[model samples]
Target: MFKYLKNDLPASIVVFFVALPLCLGIALASGAPLFSGLIAGIVGGIVVGALSGSQIGVSGPAAGLAAIVLTAIGALGSYENFLVAVVLGGVIQVIFGVLKAGVIGYYFPSSVIKGMLTGIGIIIILKQIPHFFGYDADPEGDFAFTQVDGENTFSEILNSFKQISLGSTLVAVIGLAILILWEKVLSKKAKIFQLIQGPLVAVVFGIIFYIMFGSTDTFAIKTENLVSVPIPEDASSFLAQFSFPNFEVITRGDVLLTAFTIALVASLETLLCVEATDKLDPQKRVTPTNRELFAQGTGNIISGMIGGLPITQVIVRSSANIQSGGKTKMSAIIHGFFLLISVILIPRLLNKIPLSVLASILLLVGYKLAKPSTFKAMYAAGWKQFVPFIVTIVGIVMTDLLVGIGLGLGVGIVVILYKSYQNSHFLHIEDKSNGVHKIKMTLAEEVTFFNKGAILKELDSLPKDTHLTLDVRKTRYLDNDILEILDDFREKAKQRQIHITLLSERGEVENPDSYIEFFRLRPKTA
Candidate 1:
């Protein structure tokens, strides 16, 4: 892991800057104590990173779970009671891993996965636009279409224009400029520039810019628009920030239900991120999904014990790490250390950095994930892939992550069924040999009940006095419904004065009486 220290160190710093505000903002959105987010970030980074099989995936408190945490806390009657749920949730996740539930991730289509990445990319860009212009009404980490401030996504963008902070806009522009310069030109010029990432430089610039113009009337960036880390007064006070779970209430009904909910949601989110991060990985390495579940479960357990929000493998931080050229999990581990140390030591300094700078960084990350090229590529892959891909993107933008994926997956299944119906059998008609219509129908490799409609329609349309060869020699599996359809077609064939020949690997039959009996007597051979 240490072999790529130079690469990991710089990437870790970039991920640290990206994760800090998200940790605080997600906590704020969840209505949890702000410190809880940091604790989750710390634990997710260190514990999960060390245990995980993914080389580049980063774990932390997720914005996706903010609403759940909010309701769970209220329903459970106390924040400490909610912590009990989180711990139990971790146990459930571990059980899911042992049961190999992680295989569920593989069941998702590639179109849906790509749609997820693109949808998230679009959400990040839309959500950060307000922050980019210095409108701070919405929390940085909230990814929902509907805002807690009683405003929707587009309305917030309109509001941002009315509430723009000149200083923030100026700082954001400069920060973005520096980032682009470093990425497009400087990093390519020297190893030193690569060792010191552009985001670090931009953040440093943002702090200096704030200190210089934060007091000015026309260009002042307010304290509200900056990164806010909880400041502890002394050693004893700092230690007081940690909250222990109330295990006494673990057996309560509400607690158990909340635990199960958290486990299911967190496991699903982690598996999705694992898939997305693996797609984004430059090395194209596959992450062990079940192992990732175990790692995340372990992280959540530790996080909840110390009063942290539930943890999951978050795509934003993971993408930031990958884009920053992270080579290994060392970057994630080091970022956790950074989170731990900064909150403890230099939180005051951290508070000086502008949120606009971080927003600028995320804008770049979002653009990369939802690049126009990806859309074109998906379109070129054909409607089967494009329909689900587009639907997923729209669903995610209009709703949330999971909902969008579900919508896309549904569309993808429909596309599969339609294709199956169309491809059930291939018809080849010989040109009226000897003045009698001759047709040959070859069944597909697997004919399920969904194929029954197409087969029935073809059989119904057969010409009178036709010689039909129904070939099933190549078919490996035939549904019972299709066999019944064929048996009924035999009577129709006799009424139409059509001669029917059944061709299979077993033998040839003249108008087979019972298709089911024939298949039962001569079962599929290996």
Candidate 2:
């Protein structure tokens, strides 16, 4: 791991810059203390990073959970009560890991996974636009389509132009340009560029720009527009930021319900990020999902114990790490240390860095994830893959992240059922017998109720004086629904003067009296 320090150290710094605004913004959005988010970020990085089996996955206070945290805080009556729920949620997640529920992450459709990453990428770009122009009504980390401030995403973008600050716009443009140059050109040209990422350079330039032209009224970027880290006045003030849980709320029904909700959501978000991060991993290293859950659980417990918000594996920081060439979990651990050190020793200095520069950094990350090439590539993979992928992207962009993924998963499941229905049976027409059609319907292995429609249709299409051979010889399991269909079809065949022959491993049974009885009487297979 130390060998990758040259890579991990720099990547950690980039992730640190990316994480700062998000930590504060998410806390503000959650209606929690601004420092709570920072605490979660710190614990996620240091604790989860240490325990997680994931090489590239980074944990933090997720924007995905902000709404839940916001609601739960109010619903539980106090933030202290909510902290109790967070701790319980952590315990629940540990149980989930123990039970190996993380295997569910493997079942997410590839198209949906790709769609989610693309959706998040798109969200990042759209969300950052207002910040890029220094319209700060919406915080830097809010990713919802409709803002809590009652402004919609497009409205904010349009408004940004009207409220654009000269200092922020200028700094953002320069910072973005520097990032692009460093990533696309300089990094390829030299190792130093790789060692010192573009995000760091952009941050330095933003600080310089803020100090230079920020005083002019026409160009000044206000304090509200910049990154706000709750600067602790002294040691006592810093200690006061940490909130202990109200253990009396532990037995409350609402608290338990909230705990379960947090566990379910946080675990799901973490699993999704684990899958996504592994896919984005250039080395293609698969993370141990169960271990990841355990790590996140531990982090959440610690975070809750100290007044921090819930933690999850975050795509934004995870992708930032990957993009910055992070080779190991060392980067995640180091980033946590940076958060601790910076907030403790140089928060005032951190407070000076402009939000526009951070927005520029995220813009680069977003572009890389939502590149036109990615869309084209998904489209090129064919409609089956592309449809869900596109739907997921659109869903996420238009709705919330989890809702969008649910939509994508719904589409994917429909596709699967459609394919299963189409593949249920094979049809072959041997109508060469002078006006008497001979249709051979071969059931697919493991035929289910989904195949009933196709079977019924095939039986209905049989012409008069036809010989129908319904073959299930290779089938292992035939659904009772199909048996009922076959029984009803036999009576119809009788009316049409069609001879029905049922063939299976048990040999031919022509015009059997009761299809259900015959199948039920047969010995059940293992």
lDDT value, residue 133 of candidate 1? 93
lDDT of 2 by residue, 61-174 (tens): 999899999999999999999999999999999999999999989999999999999999999999998899888888777788888888888899999989888889889999
For residues 209-292, write the lDDT of model 1, one tens digit per residue: 988888799889999999999999999999999999999998899999999999999999999888888999999999999998
Note the Cα lDDT for every prediction shown: 0.93, 0.91
Cα TM-score of candidate 1: 0.98
What lDDT score is found at residue 262 in candidate 1? 96
List clashing residue pairs in candidate 2: none
Against the true structure, what is each candidate's TM-score? 0.98, 0.96
Worst 10 residues of 2 by lDDT: 517-526
Shift of residue 428 alpha carbon in model 2, Å: 0.9
Q: Which pairs of residues collide in model 1?
A: none
